[model samples]
Target chain A: MKELTIGIDIGGTNTKYGIVDRDGNVVFQGSISTAEYEEFRDYFNGLAIALRKATESIPFAHKIIGVGVGAANGNYYKGTIERATNLKWKGIIPLADMFKEEFGIPAIITNDANAAAVGEMVYGAAKGMKDFVVITLGTGLGSGFVCNGILLNGKHGIAGEVGHTSVNPAGRFCNCGKRGCLETYVSATGIKRTVYKLLADHLEPSELRGISFDNLTTKMITESAVRGDVVALAAFEYTGRILGMKLAETVVHTDPEAIFLFGGLSLAGDLIFKPTIKHMEANLMPLFRGKVKVLPSGLQNQAAPIIGASSLVWNYLDNNKTQLQEEVY
Target chain B: MKELTIGIDIGGTNTKYGIVDRDGNVVFQGSISTAEYEEFRDYFNGLAIALRKATESIPFAHKIIGVGVGAANGNYYKGTIERATNLKWKGIIPLADMFKEEFGIPAIITNDANAAAVGEMVYGAAKGMKDFVVITLGTGLGSGFVCNGILLNGKHGIAGEVGHTSVNPAGRFCNCGKRGCLETYVSATGIKRTVYKLLADHLEPSELRGISFDNLTTKMITESAVRGDVVALAAFEYTGRILGMKLAETVVHTDPEAIFLFGGLSLAGDLIFKPTIKHMEANLMPLFRGKVKVLPSGLQNQAAPIIGASSLVWNYLDNNKTQLQEEVY
Candidate 1:
């Protein structure tokens, strides 16, 4: 019998859903605007309707195992969405229970970063590797670390928050109310702040002059660097160096085989990769100096999250064969 | 039928050995000086002879299954001793191969830190935990991280070098050439430095004042603190606070169930533990606040290394049943 699973990626803006096969091929996918706080149950009902309509054309024998939801503050163990600062939801929401009620199959939930790490491991760049770290660079820095072929959930499911670690105690204020975090130097907003600092300190000339903080974006800096803008390019180098140094410290603890970069700002290939690798090498201890590799995510854009969420289902099916068989029997 | 394994803890100055059962019981134990590097083979031969003499008085058919050796700079995968700075050996030594050749049994070698971590998991404070980190605070700081019930040996078998990580870019010059290592503030030498800094800055009459750097050990400071010396107590508090903050970063990354502190500095108990736990809770990210526990090693004194090295043999024997069956068949 053909086996199928549902993968849900709930971002701050849109919630993307896909029906995926065992091979990670998405058969059907759709997107919907995330409901404002008041319409939580009604919004899920709408999602279920859309999903049923999309999968109606598939063969009847193919069985959908369950749904796997990936949200910003989702918890795998709890199957609920924790408080997300940007989301309209002010309290915990039973997302997995609602999904199960709609689909009549077991549901799995994981945080966005954890889902992404699993996605990279099962279908993306980290295939066949036992230890690796996935870093997502967007508004803030998010990381997922896999060690010994297992996703580390820590004791309270808060492991792999690499961004909050203090790299430079006096460096910059972080969104987490900490000082000198790696995210302060490496994230998209972090790069912009660096550009602003450079503009203030040096006598350099480029396109980023006199621009308001809101007007500046990571894309603008990348475009400027591509056009031979010295300040913009230096900003990227500076960002990558600090990130690499932080990575060097992390490697000392986790000792992953490779680190995979994903999400928005990671799109600046050599702009970030070159300097990050250089600084990581310089900062590493003698034992781990030259062995760790940095790679890019194979599942680009929306596919990354969908594939990551699907991987949870695939992994669950594989590891829980006896229980699944017992249920079927 | 009964089974036994020999666990060896090779130090720069002494070599400790024990025959252990599956339940972590030491059947027999002995120690010898390892000062002469060139005569390692001779030393082991004599050591084995002594062990055999001890076992002759026992009542069992004592078949040694394997030998697990823990040294300063050992690698598990390649089973090689990569030039330990403290030991006289200046080149790579295939110590496991030598042991296997002499004993006619499978042998494994790993760094002392990794061994200690394995020890903690199997028979020490971290028992029953799926994830934990063991920090050994001796002359230098050594770390061993366990994730999902397995040791994390990064890409080149050189992960978990947490001591060398820089907390302050301008803090202190580390032996590894890095500035502001965590060890620079938490180790015995680190405490001495803290004392001098406090004395120089505060002009306080400390029992530690006017003492030579070599003479002022962590023991003396702990003793002074026990006697109500303000400066000594302040030094412990300072060191613990720094260690706590560093551990907070560690918790965010690996998310171990608990962190176990072993070795000489941990002997101070409340002097280090009280302040370390208090400060760790203070600096933790809101998500991790009051979640992770920090505690001391259950394996006290010389038993730590013996239990740790024996854990390797037990783990290997448990996992290598196919090989064992093949040999028996």
Candidate 2:
């Protein structure tokens, strides 16, 4: 029988899952509305149903050996989601335990960014690379660091919170009650924030001036930038400049060979890539200048999260081979 | 027969060396003036003679297994010192190869800070910890990062250059032509600079005002602070505040369990430690708050560099056990 794993990505709005084989092929997939289930029990029940339906439909149902979950604030060490602000659950939810009980398989959990980093390592751009960083640029910036070929799950399994690292102590205010966080100036919302600031600061005429903050999106800005809109181009440049400086600072901590960009904003392609690379090189210490590569995630956009989630199982098994073998027998 | 290793620490002014046993005990020690040799060949010859003389006097000379070197700008991978500004040599000096050729033993090299980190891991405070950072606060700031119990040597073998990381983009001018680097605000010279700035900014009664910038030292500032001089107190407070903030930012990157402070400035003790810990906790993200400890290095002042250098050989042997075993046989 072909071995497979069930990968689940739990987001605020939707929960995505798929039956993925060892080769990263998605045999079957499904989704459920996450916000509809206000209670943790209801969410778990819904997840169980979705997972079963996806797996049962596949021809190789018994081949599924394990389950892996990727979620916001997921703790790999504890297998719990601790006070995730976006979720309706108020306290720690033992999601991994629920999955293990429901599926009768080894289950593992980690934060989405770490899952993404594992995905890159197991099946994407960071293949065979021991030291690298993965930055997920969505509504907020998320990061996962791989050092010496292991995920840097520091003392508390929250090591790669690069987005929260302050770039300017007195700069922009962040949702996390801190000022000058890297995320406030580098995410998709960050780009939108930059566009609004640019529109307010400079009177330069451009297509982005009329869009209000609530209606504006990074995608629209990218389209405008492609069309040669001055304000949109400037927004990307500013965002990239801050990101580059932050990455340069990160480089001194753990000299990553490459920093891979993942998630929605990365789709902007060269609009974001060009300026980020330029500033990263400019801000780098002389020894690291032109040495580190800024690249895009190798996984497809929609499937990247699921793939990342799936990789957690393989990683867990690899690290716990002796215990896993005993349990299997 | 007991096993021993020769540890060499090459600084701008003096080169310190010692023969150390497996238990971190120094059997014999000596020093040579580095400035006396302008030519690399002359320096190597002098170093060979010094090593011979030091080992010949020791009772168990045949028991020495290997040699380790710690120097400014030392590259672990290349075993060379590249363009060290303080040294007379202008280009890459193959120091490790020279030691290997002269002594016919396994030799290794790494920067002093990295050596110090390994020393802490093998024989100091970080004995059981898998993740920690060692900050050496001397004339300049030097950092060694240990993640998952391995020293973080990036792709170029020059990771953990935390001193160069910018805290404030426009804060202070650094010797490396960068503005607002952490070293510019946190090192021995950094405190001295802070004292001068404080003198110019405040009209408070301070004995420091009488001293020129070149004459003022961190030691003198500490002495003045001990005497309840307001300016000196404020300088320490300011320096601690900036260091705390930078460390908090560093926490989000690798999430070290504890940050160990070593070198000259660390002698100020609670004068620097108290404020730094307070601000580090205050600036930390809620998840990391009260989680990471700010502590002092375990090694004594005079022996830290030599011990750190010695650790390089042990680390090298551990990592290259198969090759080392083959060579030994």
Candidate 3:
């Protein structure tokens, strides 16, 4: 029988899953209300039922070889989800073991960013590239680093956390209880924060000045910038500059060949990429300048979540024989 | 015959070599003047003659299995020393190949910091730890990052360069044509800079005030700090705080279990370690705080250079069956 793997993306509100073939095709897919289940066991029970029904309904004869999951604060090494802030589940949860029991197959789990990095490596832009970084610029920035063809899970499976790497000690307050984190200036919400700061600083006539902070959206800013709104353009420039500087700083450590921007703020395209590339080059050491590429994530954003989740299992299957035995990462 | 490896450390003024056993014992060693030989080929030939004579003089009839070298701007992947600022070599020089030709053995070469990191992993503090960073604080700063038990050579073999990562865009002029590099505030010279700045800022009488910039040394500052000199104490504190803050930032990237401080400045002990640990913890993310250890190198400072260079060969021989084949580093 043709083999397929299941990819499950667990978010705060919605939990999405997909049955995917080795070629990145989604054979079947579905979503469930995560917040409605309340209990952790109930949530998995409902998911398993839905997945089972979906598998039975598929027209093609195929076997699910494994399962992969992506969630906030997921630990690849320990296979536990530790105190995920967005999820109602409190404390450390044994998500991976639960996944294996429910699926009756080998299952792997890691943080969404790491999953995205694997997805890029398996079936997207970073194919055949061992050294690259995936930066997810969503509500909060997330990062996954791939060094020498292995995901950098670190000693405690918490190594690739560039989002929390503070850009400024006294710049801005972040939700993670840290001051001036990179995400505070570079995420989708980070761009919005910059827009408001620009608005408050300048009485310059602009479309964004009319919108209140609550109603202000990154989409509106993008649209405004596309239409040549000075404030919106400046916001993108400021955000890119901050991101570029951090990328330059991070480059010296990980030394990735390419850095993929993969979320809502990234949709701004050249508006974000141009200034970020400019500042990053300006700040980089002489040896690294003109060498590193800042590119868009190859995976389509709408399907990226489930695709990333499933790629973990595929990666596990591919490298399990050698990587698992030798590296222990 | 018993197996052994030769380790060579190439400096601007002197070239040091050691015939070391697998257990970190130096059975024979010697030094030659590097600058006296105007040509690179002649220098290697002269050094090879000295090594051969030293090998014959040794009482034990051990066979040299391989050679490892450490130098400024050494590239591990390419096996070349490229445009080293301190050395007279004008461009990329194939040091490893030359070593192999001269010694009739397999050879390896890496930057001094990376060699030191491998030395720690093979015979020093990080013997069993898979993830660690070694920061060398001498005339300038140097760094080697080992993530997931493999040295991060990056895409271009220049990845582990935390010393050049700018702490401030406008802080201080670095010899590398960069501004505000971490080395400017954390090396032996960095402490001296801090001392002079403190003396200039404070009217408080200092023993250092009478000394010229060229006359004052890090040893005098260390002695003064030991004797409870306020200005000297303040300089160490300032230096440590800067180093600590950079360490906190760096920890998020490679996520080392321990960071070993080596070379001249690291000799100051608690004067550097205490404030560095304090500021690093303070600036760290909630997860990493109190988790990372800042320690001194396990090797004696005087012998560390030769030992670090030589350990590369032993590490190669030990892991050649597995690590070198798989990782290709």
Error of 1 at B181 (Å): 2.1
Q: lDDT value for candidate 3?
A: 0.85
- Evaluate all candidate structures by whole-model CA lDDT and list the values in order: 0.82, 0.86, 0.85
Two-way DockQ contest, 2 vs 3, winner: 2
For candidate 3, give fnat to 2 decimals: 0.68
Quote the positional error of residue A198 for candidate 2 in Å.
2.0
Q: Which residue pairs come into collision in candidate 2?
A: none
Ranking by TM-score: 2, 3, 1
Write down the lDDT that model 1 would get: 0.82
Candidate 1 true-interface contact recovery? 0.76
The CA lDDT at B70 in model 2 is 79
Ranking by lDDT: 2, 3, 1
Docking level for model 1: medium
lDDT tens string, model 1, A218-303? 88999999999999999999999988888988888877888888877789899999999999988886667778998887777767
The residue pairs in collision within model 3 are: none
What TM-score against the true fold does each predicted structure earn?
Answer: 0.94, 0.97, 0.94
Provide chain B's TM-score, model 3. 0.93
Candidate DockQ values, in order, are 0.72, 0.79, 0.74
The window of 10 residues in a row where model 3 chain B has the poorest summed lDDT is: B320-329
What is the Cα-based TM-score of model 3?
0.94
Per residue, candidate 3 scores C-alpha lDDT tens digits across A1-329 of 78788898887789999888899998888899988987888988899899899889665666777778888788888899887766888888898788667766767888888999999999899999989999988778889999999988888887777888878899789877789999899998899899888888998899887898889888899999999999999999999999999999889887789999998889889999999999999998877889889999999667788999998977887877665324222
C-alpha positional error of residue B322 in candidate 1 after TM-score superposition, expressed in Å: 3.2
